[model samples]
Target: MGAATFNRRSFLKGALMAGAGVASGAMLSGCAPQSASDAAGSGSDGAAPMTADAYEKLTWSFEVPPEPVDESQITQTIADDFIVIGSGVSGLVAAASILGHGGSCTLFSAGTKAVSRGGSNHAVGTKTQKRLGLDYTPDTVAAHFNNEIARQGYRMDSRKWWKWINQSGEAMDWITDIMDKAGYTTTLELPFKDPNGTFSIPGGAHNFYGPEIQNSANDGEPLLTATLEQYILDNGGSITYNTKAEYLIRENDNTGRVSAVVATNADGDYVKYEGAKGIIMATGDFSGNPDMMAKYCSAFADYVADGAGDYDAEFQFGGLMPGDGQKMGLWVGAAWQNTTPSAPMIGWYGFPAPCSDQNHPGILLNVEGERFINEDTSSVYAGYAVSGQTEKKVFAVWDSDFAYRFDTWEALGNNMDNLGITPVTADEKAAEFEAGVEEKTYVKGETIDEVLQALAEQGGIDVEAAKATIIRYNDDVAAGNDTQYHKCKEYLIPIEKGPFYGQYNQLGPAQFLCVLGGLRTSPDCEVLDEANKPIEGLYNVGSMMGDTFGTFYNFRVPGQNLGMTCITFPYVLGKQLTGN
Candidate 1:
């Protein structure tokens, strides 16, 4: 019944094709390796012949090495009571919680170390916790969840949403306590209050800006991963970095129980780590895999290009996510939920490179030249809105006043900076501002009409329509209202000032760490099959499970995602696994 004993037979049988067909089999098996001779034998007289099956199989490897390792590279095995995939927020939290619950666990990550620079921890959502003297009761949390779900037309499972909402407060408390113990000051305050208005639950919900927690600058993902890794090690747990889980070893064809996880280490050696109790699929989202994204993510389907032809680089950790867990779950007949709503935070503006600063608040115009939703809203909504526009590209237009106000405006300043604005101060930083403008990093326009004209010409918008649109926007702002778009009155400032600017805003395709729909799971984090049946001994946390956000990005709740993964569900999963 133990994973090792159960996998011993499959391991031997797979060894036959370890070098030849291992690579191909690995893709299908989700964890097998291809052998050298098998690869060579399929070739035609040394002409590098491409086998149909090999090509198909190799596509699944995502990122394959140039050559397969010799059998000599095979190495030692590390077994544990539990094996958690991925080392990001979810994986680390699971490992820490399992260890905290007195279980010996092994953590595996595709990358080296938990904090892989610009990973998930780079940016986190902030939530008000009761510990920080913020009035966040269970009812309020439930309302927040309901708000998100209602936006999606209730496409999500209400039971699971309620479960996460109920546990959110406790999860925040646990994570904050852990962070404090790890020498980081945990604040319970909201970083920025919603400019729109107070969120109301049915029965009188309180609103108070809680105390400021430690700013997660140097103390972000790196600190969090380091702290959790130390906790695991101290509690008799082991961690293996640069190791990837290939596939789950199932107990039987009819059963959903995963016996062990087969993977290859950094040295390219095949090793099977037995999961005595279960396997937790915390592998990050599938933003990296364009193929998977095209298949599963409707938003990304039309946008992603087939560049470089490397599936791994295309999907796995390639700015978005590779949808590894999503693919695995799908293969095993796991039903997916909440595919309609994209990650609230993900937007075309957040796309990396070329179109940097897309997340910054700017005037978004359709191809015909018209303002759409508020630019400061969730990127997911913005991106989706752009996708629905005439052309895939939307124009982000602004002026010198907009930039200046963005730097000094109380509510908008910090958010602008968070969206990658430079020249923090405008007083003595005039020279720096001028330099940035010259370099075209921060755009500048001398006149409102000129900026609109330039943006129209550069971004393929109708010049006349764009000019008229700006006039209408200014008129609305002067009237103290945004009748067309309903943007906040504070942001409805007239753009009559000179020195306008424009940037060709293309939709962000995938820049890694994506939030795609995931497998359906129970409130306790148990993975469910297509029939709404639980796959016993298999749990999913973090982005691996969808429907958490329901349909839309309701209100901005910081640290909600990370808080849930690192604090709430991990504790829930650990207790469930250990029968506590």
Candidate 2:
């Protein structure tokens, strides 16, 4: 399973959890001593400090095992050309690439099998994009990246950002070639339209369309992981299941090289695997660890705690990625990234659009029925805007005429695939609206007054205030200019039409697919020490590798996060390590 699979499925269920629960660490034996309290400012009682500022300075230090595993108690030891921790896309891709080049590899996974996988890859200019005639260019994307860093107030390694995007096309081609041979075909996912046009460079967000991996007798379907896993094994590599990489065994000399990894096997026995070349850490983010989240991701963590929404709902169903790789790296003196806490990449979660704009044109309103932002904005801004609202709740109000006004298939039909929502065809939208009339997921009224009355009674909106808002909006539409928000005139479909509708839309504590910000790494995915030198024979990939993003994930480019972490960087690191 890739990272996106679990999130998509859980989001559909609409299970909402209230304020944050006790942040529990993963229970493991033979890894390290279990502390009554984690190091993220928790006391012996396992409770975080009450105040926010105290939580900010908390040390997120890892507790090393008190003593090394006794030689007599050691289980079977394995030797490999390269050791890869974490069987997620990063590790699997690296292992497969290494083995493909005649290098022996061993992949260790914390869970019983691969789980929590995603499907999309963001590429620059590829054969697919060329054929699709998408106008996204490297220069444009570079500019977008530059602007994003400035806007978010986060810094990225410019060299790394340029290097990754420069090679992204080749990386996509390489991975898709392997996937094609393995009976998997890459399909272009839906792209988001900006106010000008499609935000994606023609054929962005490529998803692997293939057979789902078989269900494990234990838990977690291989899904996207199955193909890469099989490729590695077919090439004479091995995957160790139910094994947790407890620590990186660095060389005793002053070279700062991590020579091997020590892991806890399924039998609760310690095992060591020595890597002749290097070790790649692909373990995902630290969202599962409450202490780490509070210490670093405290802003959003506390936001969710104060009834924003369950930010952890996205990870509730999958492997609790407890920042094991991050902890292991930090224990070896790797520098934590000096960036904003890992920001979540959120989707619309079926948030309706209020207006019609080329890119993300929707009529967004606060709970009080007042438009808060220009509806034609990116999902990142939309998510941020809603989160800042008093209630963190919004509504995407439209009318029945919206079906006839826009390309139903393009607008609402592919909405979910474009981000997150049920795929709605024109007929489905009409049908669902009728059903929502009965179910009240949608409020329907024959007249404008009727709709306002329904909205006032059911939606907690003030009838008089709501009427005044709509009247003003309609007046602006008639004047051919939006005075308040300055939304493009084309999207200002007045609410004057009959049969209005609206749905409850929440932006924040909207579950994120994964959090960015982890161990700082170079362009080639080498983990850098505190002195800013590459730690020899050590690399990191996947979400664990950081320094390419800032405060927020770049939602502007769909799949870029997975592209850089899971595909591009792993491939680059693999070739570098293998001397290919």
Over the stretch 375-476, how does candidate 2's per-residue lDDT look in tens digits? 666655677777787567766567776765555544321321232333346666567678877976777777767776665565566567666777788788
Residue-level lDDT tens digits of model 1 in 533-566: 8876777887667766655433244445555544
Off by over 4 Å in 1: 1-77, 116-132, 140-142, 188-219, 254-256, 302-318, 330-333, 338-345, 348-363, 373-380, 403-436, 481-483, 486-488, 510-513, 552-555
- For all candidates in order, the CA lDDT equals 0.56, 0.63
Q: Give the number of the best model, judged by TM-score.
A: 2
* Candidate 1 TM-score over all chains jointly: 0.72
lDDT of 2 at 551: 68
Total clashing pairs in model 1: 37
Candidate 2 residues lying further than 4 Å off, grouped into runs, are 1-57, 60-67, 134-154, 190-193, 196-202, 210-223, 253-255, 302-320, 353-360, 411-425, 437-440, 447-459, 508-510
TM-score of each: 0.72, 0.80
